[model samples]
Target: MNFTRINGLAFAFSAIKYIRYNQDFTKTTATKTTDPRPWLGLDGLVLALVCLLFLILATGDGSGNESDARLVLTTRRRRVQRRLRILSSVPSALIVFLLGLILCFIRDPTIFSDIKLGPSRFHVLKITWDDFKVGFVRGAVPQIPLSVLNSVIAVCKLSGDLFPGTELSATKVSVSVGVMNLVGCWFGAMPVCHGAGGLAGQYRFGGRSGLSVVFLGLGKLVLGLLFGNSFVRILSSFPVGILGVLLLFAGIELAMASRDMNSKEESFVMLVCAAVSLTGSSAALGFGCGIVLYLVLKLREMDFSGFPFFRSKSEPTAEDESLINP
Candidate 1:
């Protein structure tokens, strides 16, 4: 099949994998569905929705404060246009998108289900709201206009002084990687969250996908050295529709890869999570849903002892024991 067709099919499957199931399954069922290959469509849909939401918010006409932002954007139209011009290029998207693609493909322990389909290792991290210290101290208070840019510049200068040589260390590599990841995550930058994907996928790390992420890092390094700002400027110009297409495909591939959550309960939960994520932020939605689910099960008089993540459910199992609610 053509790549587009494959992408669409994958997205559909992923949605199936991620949606809310509204019920639980027998232990046998969960085991039977753990392969994780059928959920690609869901991932594609989720990411596509994320990008689309951002584009709608950025481009849509809004109230006074927003109009003022647009006015500022228009006042700087040439600069924005210049940026858009560069972003529209194929190579730029390839370079940027490739960063994400490589991460998806090369991450350790495989974030997706199919071992043959992506990196040898994959990981999924759950960030709870309670994990934060919930305090603002010193110069760190959520965005205050141009302070972020200044801070970044300060770091850049410090980095140069700290290294003071042509050589790169693990720390330097991590610093550069982190900066790229942040840039990609914000202001239309992508391919920055390499973390487990790059590290686990690399040589002797039991990674099959390491080569892909390595190439991406290397590509960025080359761009930094050879093309530099001009190359970056060009990459910044890609259209929303094009990125939508890419995100759509990427999400599908990822969701399809997460086929292990195949129980009716898991699938339903995924759908609910995706919808919530699409409508709101994923973290908020995930946490809210988790709380509700916990409560609902408790209300139904289901013993917390049998449920996953409960204090009672984690004891070492005997050979005769199975993952049942009984």
Candidate 2:
């Protein structure tokens, strides 16, 4: 009908597509086991609640003492505002979780049905000198530089785009976290790094303050304690399409942030950077190419400025002005 109606219909269709895409249809021959976790049963309920909330929040008040013409206009404006608020207020995580739940229901997977926690082994306490030597020479020495560079770049790019003006020390924080994770690895913890994808995902999912990190750490702790053996299975069950959507949005947001580079030269450099990045899928290569292009352009500009023929005809050179005057 109208533009507003078309937009609303488009959004509705997109939501349906997301739900359909997440529906797992891989036929399994095994019998489905009953899930004992309280949270497991609440998936559909949560989705319904979220949808109901969205509908309620997105609907505007129609009651007014205005004429029929004014009422229609006012109603449309309120509906638009409500839609914006609903879109902005919904957290990305909720969408991901809903998608995962839908997939789980459709597949009826039982991959985690046999998970059970057992007693820890005592051999983990027996650390040998050879282990330390090997770790130092083989693991730490070669990986540290690359890890540090990745962390610094990720932090700088994310902070520059999403949290500008926030004072964040990339080196100090990266090193500190690296050291902590390194120590944790000695006791069988997985090697961890501050990855760009992780940072982007966090930002995409409504993580703005340091409290988000704290809450994440706390959630991990709780999960590890409550479902030690099942943690891997739980995470592995998430739909791939849902994760792709999250990453897609995160990349879009980061790319859109680069629009602030308004100067023509900077814009050209940015386009080069984007092209190289997309072509190679490497941030380091893209950055290097941008730097090289910028330098080449600068050198060419300097060389052209020095040539008399390239100079603007509106301004006379010192030699030409003196000759004319004489």
- Candidate 2 local lDDT, 52-143, one digit each (tens): 34433432221112334545557787776566656556664665566675566456557546455643342344568998899889988766
List runs of model 1 lying over 4 Å from the truth: 1-192, 195-208, 298-326
lDDT of 2 at 227: 64
Error of 1 at 190 (Å): 11
What lDDT score belongs to each candidate, Candidate 1 first? 0.38, 0.54
267 Cα displacement, candidate 2 (Å)? 2.9
Model 2 / residue 119 / CA error / Å:
9.1
TM-score of each: 0.34, 0.60
Name the best candidate (by TM-score): 2
lDDT of 1 at 195: 28
Q: What is the clash count of model 1? A: 53
